[model samples]
Target: MKNNSAMTKIPKGYTTITPWIISRNTARLIDFMKKTFDGEEIARLYNEDGSVGHAEIRIGDAVVMMFDAKKEWPDTPAFLRLYVEDGDAAFRRALQEGATTMTEMTDMFFG
Candidate 1:
C-alpha cells in the first residue's frame, strides 16, 4: 500500500488495531508517551473530576488510546515498546528521562 493512499475504512494517520491503555493516571501516561516518542495529542476528553476520560495520541502514524482507571475499570498491565532509529541513544535518553530499565540492550539471536 502506498504511504499516501487514502484509507476508506480507518481514519487517516491511524491504524486498524490501536492499543488502549487503562492506567491509574492517564495524564502521566500521556505525558510520558508524548515526551518519549514525540507523540502528538490529537484528542482528549476529561471527566467531571478532572481526570482523563479518554485521549488519543498519534505516534509515528499510529494512535494509542488511554483512559483513567475507574472504580469499576481497574488498571491493566500494558506493554508498549517504542522503536527508534538509534536504539543505543534512545535507551540512554530514556534512562535520563526517568524510564526504569527492565531489560538491558543485547544482541538478539534473531538478528
Candidate 2:
C-alpha cells in the first residue's frame, strides 16, 4: 500500500485519537476543567466574531479539544471518564467547585 498523502496524517505531539467537546460555553467548560482536574489550556483558535473556533486543554497526559457550538451544528453531549490519583479528594473538589453529584463515591473493583 502507498501513503495517503505527502504530509503526515496525525499532527506531531498529538495522539491517534482525541476527544473533541462541543459546548455552548467553551470558556466556562475550560474553567471547570481547570478547577475540577487541574487542566491547563494548551491552544485556542478563535473566530472573527470572538467565539472559540477550537481549543485544547491538557489534564495530566490526556488532551481534550473543545469548540463553541453554533445554532447550525447539532448538539452532541460527551461524557468523559477521568482517572485521578485520589478519588475521594477529586470528588470532594468537584463538589466544592459546583459539580452536582450524580452518584456517591464508593470503592469498586473497576476503580
Candidate 3:
C-alpha cells in the first residue's frame, strides 16, 4: 500500500477503521468500556424506547462506536486490541466487569 494520507480525505484525529459493537445489552457494554478502559464518552444517541441507538467512546486516541442490536438486526460483535499503560490492570478491570478472556494476556514486541 502506498502512503497516500496526504491525498486521502479523512476526519482529523480519526483512523481508517473504527470498532463497532452491536449488542443486545448495549448499556452494559458501554458501561463496561467506560469502567474497564477509562473510556471517555464522546456522544450517544438514544432510541425513543430508551435504548441506545448509537454511541461513541474514546479510549486513548481510538474512537469506538457501538449500538444496540435491534430486532431487525442480528447481533454483531467486535473484537478490539487496545494498548494501555497497564495491560495487566486493564485485564483485571475487564474481568471485574464480567469479561472473559479466550486466553491469558501475553506481552507483545510491538507493545
Best by TM-score: 3
What's every prediction's RMSD, in angstroms?
A: 4.4, 2.8, 2.9
Model 2 C-alpha lDDT per residue in residues 1-111, reported as the tens digit of each score? 887674477777677678999998788889888988999999889999889999999998889999999978888878888999987888888888777888888888997
Q: How many backbone clashes does candidate 1 have?
A: 0
Off by over 4 Å in 1: 1-7, 71-73, 109-111
TM-score order of candidates, top first: 3, 2, 1
Candidate 3 clash total? 0
TM-score, per-candidate, Cα-based? 0.79, 0.81, 0.82
Q: What C-alpha lDDT does candidate 2 achieve relative to the native structure?
A: 0.87
Global fold similarity of model 3 (TM-score): 0.82
Candidate 2 positional error at 107, Å: 2.5
Show the colliding residue pairs in model 3: none
Q: Which candidate, 2 or 3, would have the higher TM-score against the true structure?
A: 3
